[model samples]
Target: MKTLIVEDSATLCAIYSQYLDGSGLEVTSVETLADAKAALVDWHPHLVLLDIELPDGNGLDLLNETVNLSSPPAVVVMTGHGEAHAEQAIQLGAADFLTKPFDASRLRVTLLNAAEKLTLSQQVETLAVKREYLGPLMGSSSAMQSVYETVESLAGTLATAFIMGESGTGKELAARAIHQLSARAPGPFIVVDCASLATDQLERALFGTDGEVAQGLVAQAAEGTLFLDEVCSLGFASQATLLRLIQHGTYRPVGSAAEATADVRIIASTNRDPLFEMREGRLREDLYYRLHVVPLRMPAMRERSDDILMLAKDFLDRIAHEEEKDAHNLSDPGAQALRGYSWPGNVRQLENTMRQLLLTSTSTEIDESAIHQVISVNEISVGNAMRSRPSQLAESAMEPSTIQPLWMTEKKTIEEAIAACDGSINRAAQYLEVAPSTIYRKLQSWKAQNLNV
Candidate 1:
């Protein structure tokens, strides 16, 4: 601890030096209030031991300044007269007060206690500052810095933002971060999965159905954020409805005569290129401009090679805790392998792989073999995706000889990928270029059919 002693009497100051001797604290002494103020301007001691009777001014004056300063130091006031001022000093933000003719034995213990409190207080302040930048997010790389800057800029506004990134690059996380930081953080944040919304029922889901007025996600999300995930998948009719919603603050549900006002902040995300969507007429150009008011492009995992192990280790530790496993971290070789291998599926794939390792590998440290196994599975998926010729699955699906349900073909292909990956659904999902949820839902449907998945 850094302590400043403000005492005018030279003999008393010497006595204080003797009491504080060998206490492992850096001590500085000043005799007058003017010198004390000068020292305070730059010294910024953690604890100030002040004598009320100073040469030029009362120690209470300096105490008041210390209390009101932006980053104030702890104060312990002393007086040669009486102990009555102790109560008054504490009410003015002094940590504690002491009378002159101080007890030498008690002085050491008093300073030590104050030092401990100062240390803990500084630690809490530091944690609060760090959390403002990285509470839900991890990794302190430059790639993440840019994202943080954009998040900060958009957090206080009501602009409709579009977060663009590859699948599993944490687009939803970015959207949630914006909502959590915004002024509307306390209000509801509803996510409408545009890709999953049925075309025939999207209007009802967003605006509302006929009977129930509050059936719409937008109406429910009033005064908060409405997140549209995979918005590029929305059909033209849905796109037109959404454009109208953005252009005007009012939206009328299906079969409703009155138009209800919905004050909502829109945040949308898509893995597909938004420009391509506009060019192909999938996404309305006017709606694109509205959402493009604030554009956030998340850096892919491979692009942020600096954050690979950081993210990997974080996932490992969390998985270990949840599963009650003793595996604490990744080995140096494992970390190196992770950085070297190209992550075709980004953060989500890495997280899923870590979960798999914690569940399957008994070794405390995730070794290089586990890393290679996961990467090799992803590599196979990329190879298969690349080898599929132009028109991709369309060319094969239209074969007259097959004459089978398209879903059966898709199920067979997905199952083969899972079997090939030795029953790892995450790796299979990566190979099939779909969300893990899609794979899980498909397996559930197959299970209902009494068919092996």
Candidate 2:
């Protein structure tokens, strides 16, 4: 530990220097308060062995400054005067107070104890700063940067936001990023997957049971964020309950008599079109509007194509570090194949592919062949096939065996593209080989038809 002895008496300072030096501690001695202040400003010592009675000023003056300063070092005050001064020093944030003419044995033990406390304090503050932010959402691409900024801007506001993206698009991670940046970051971040739970199970999970005073999903997420994934799959009754909670901020347990208030920021996600669900009346229109206050449409991997290799490298490095092995760099052909192939599963698929390569490959450099083995076109197709809901395939296949007019089919294709890209009109137009204005016109026409429907 680095120790600073602020004693005006030259003899006493020399004695302190000799004793602390022999004890294997780096010691610096200053005879006046001015030199002490200079040392404190320049080299922040781990422990300040301050003498209260300095030549120019009392050490008590520096105590207030030390305690009040940001990143203050610990102080261990010493006095050659009365007990009153010792008590005063302890009151002003002194970790320990020692009287003059103290034995070296006691001073050594006290300084050691003070050093431990200081080390632990620094460690705790570092961890606190780290926990204040969630995991790195690694992407510097304009598309990803926009997503980051949107989450940051909306984090402080207590409004519901709906995030729509395909599976493996990191919806939950996005939700967590929002919460980490939010004012209620210290509160619970509860995630409820509507698609994973049965109707009865979802009901019990969201709105706790009768005998137990169930803290519904909203209640459990009070003053925090509630992430409801695959919200379109929520049963009709649960949808109604969730709608009531969002609208009125009030809900009751499934079988309870007591009504509870919900003060939560609901962030809902779905792979399917919430509008389609609303159109079919499977998802209530009112609930849709309530949760869609600030709809954040997460772009699919194809839309954010620039970030493909960057994300792949990031995941690869993470896996390497986790396995305690040197990082495997991607070859040119490997990178080319990564960017060329469509990541239908988005970021999640890329992460899995990186892990698979790390597990299977023995070489330090990952080549295109290794990548192809892990991320085949057929493998991706199979993944997409598995992700497709029965209704989604049925809707796609049952879209009139009799072909519609070319213009009408083209319009429908653009609409589907827009939905697939999470409402990016520019991407939709690019996918359709048309101008953005044309996409807007088609969207307007679709809206008109929706009104009629």
Candidate 3:
């Protein structure tokens, strides 16, 4: 480790320097506060041995300045014998005190312990910052509180987690919370999309190649977390590979004989039921068992009726802040419309709608007209509307489309698929297991019906 010795006495500075150097620590000695500050900013030492009195200024003043440091090195104050000086050093967050003429062994032990504590404290602060940045999952409902509790409980453990939720319900966010809370918080948190990559590409990404040696998400998340989204879509071969990794914590690169051990915790997320997938032969039962250690289910927006308005306002504020525009206050009618709407697209869809409204609305206050425009343009059904908690909704009838019924069955099916995919058109089509062309054809046909203004 590196050490800095700051003392006004030139003899003591030199003596401590020689002792620290002999102990295999790189040491820099400075006699004045100015030189000490310069060395601290430039050298970034692991520990400091600071004298209480300085020729230019009291070392306590220097200690006060060091606390502003982004990553402050530990300070061990050296005082001449006054109780006042020792008390001041302790108040200023000095790691420990060394009386003048202290033994070399005592100084070394104190420095070593302080350095270790400093490292641990820094790690804890980093994790706290990460959790704060991620924000709470944004719900006031009991179900959401329960979900939050589960996430908090799992965050410190190494157990594999399986998250089951509709699309746009924040599965990845929950996985991140778990990783940040876990013992491996310092390591990387890697994400893998099982549905996005082709089977061959997926295998290559997960298992890696011989010549190039790609660090598969699992390998990259060594001593951390690997989050698998849309895991139910993984092909049998990939599923088997994943199962092996979960079971044995060992995997070989695509063509290598040497097996590497993975210390990663697996967090798999899927909109589909893993049990259903397994029963249908789409997912292996053994793999399902391996991944389903702790199951966390996120409630749908409809289920958390009380939190609808809060979520809406939160989204509106976020959008307005991002755009650098005045946030629009929702009038009672507008608030009612939001609460009444089924929100088939869930939180993500609500966020996007708020952004669109903020962009389109000319007035500072969002009124019923603006809400109706969003609903009409988006073609949300009235039957699915006005169903949330009374605290959220303003009771009023939305005009039904006067247009003749046109493939109502197909529209219902599309809506179902969209909801199943968490509002992803592509994934919705995939769930229908139909060609993209077919979805496009049906959408075009529905638009041609020219539903009322």
RMSD of each: 18.3, 15.8, 17.0
Index of the highest-TM-score prediction: 1
- In model 3, the runs with Cα more than 4 Å from the true position are 1-136, 380-453
Residue 154 miss distance in model 2 (angstroms): 1.2
Per-residue lDDT of 319 in model 2: 95
**Tens-digit per-residue lDDT, 269-388, candidate 2:** 999898877754457667788888887777889988888887888888989999888889899998998999888878988898889898888998999999898877558779799877
Which run of 10 residues does model 1 get worst, by summed lDDT?
A: 127-136
Model 3 per-residue lDDT tens digits across residues 1-453: 788899998998877776665676778889999999998888988788999788999888878988889888899999996778988898988988888777778877888788789889989886444221233477767777788778887886788899998888888888888888778889998999889887678767877877545567666777788899999998766776778888998888777888877778889999998887765456776888888888999787788777778878888898899999997889999899988888777887788788888999999899888988987877645444544445222344334554335567567877788888888887875566544445666677668886332
Candidate 1 residues lying further than 4 Å off, grouped into runs, are 1-133, 381-453
lDDT of 1 by residue, 1-453 (tens): 788999998887888988888998788899999999988998988888998877798889999899777878888888767767788788888887777666877888778887787788889887545322444667677788788889888897888899999998998888889999999998999999999886667888888866776879988898899999998888766776788888897788889888888889999999989887674445666777887888999999988888888788788888888988885678888888889877768999889888887887867878899878866776787789977756745756767675767668778998899999999997886665454566787778788998742
| lDDT (C-alpha, whole model) for all candidates | 0.82, 0.80, 0.80
All candidates: TM-score = 0.59, 0.55, 0.54
